[model samples]
Target: VVDRLNLQAIVPSAQTLQEQSSRMHLKKLKTVVTYWATRQIITYNVPPLAFIIAANTNVNTGALINLYSDLQKVAIEDLFNKS
Candidate 1:
């Protein structure tokens, strides 16, 4: 089962970017992330922590790692059941 959303669809293709140019690809990805964040699609604390973790990366590396572990707390069945 697809327990988690496919992030690749949302983020620019890493492989494609590498083929073109790593620097350009990274810039594109950063731009996309900045755009998404500025749009306020993923606001702070309004959505679940899971959603915040998925969208934002300004958090510290250790915090991010902890948040990722929280993903395991979400059952696969719950993910499938979400509308």
Candidate 2:
């Protein structure tokens, strides 16, 4: 299922992390485009180094909202429930 596929993707990245001496950590970057209630699209970019951590860690929604708020006005409900 989805979990297995996600794990398969993580293994290689985990090895890379170890080999890199743990100096680097994972981060997930997301980009969103919204058009005044006409359309909304969200895109996620997972760096190869991040796949391992992503498989295990839950993203912090509050932090993401704070990060993206500078780009535009972000509503908590819109982000969490996608309404």
Candidate 3:
């Protein structure tokens, strides 16, 4: 569906709503509030354009993106071990 709509980037900003750890509550508050603010500003002030860039993700997602590789010895061995 996204490809059909020609949407290049789908910021999962709201994905932060899933944060459930007490340790991450503060960070979640910041992320949700920031996303809301940006959404409001863009919705009322500036309209979407062809080349506009946006981002959306929490710590886990951010770290996943930054990870260079997921290849692992255990993963490879498991793949070959008919389970």
- Compare the candidates by TM-score and give the number of the best one: 1
TM-score of 2: 0.21
Assess every candidate by TM-score: 0.29, 0.21, 0.19
Using lDDT as the measure, the top candidate is: 1
Candidate 3 lDDT (Cα, 0 to 1): 0.31
lDDT of 1 at 3: 50
lDDT of each: 0.37, 0.34, 0.31
Per-residue CA lDDT of model 1 for 1-83, tens digit only, reads 34595655544444543454444354333121222331212212211432332344454444444543345456344655895
Off by over 4 Å in 3: 1-56, 60-62, 66-68, 71-74
Per-residue C-alpha lDDT of model 2 across residues 22-54, encoded as one tens digit per residue? 333322234322111222222223221111123
Better of 1 and 3 by TM-score: 1
Kindly state the number of residue pairs that clash in model 2: 0
Give residue 15's lDDT in candidate 2 (0 to 100): 44
Q: How far is 71's C-alpha from truth in model 2 (Å)? A: 35
Can you list the residue pairs that collide in candidate 3? none
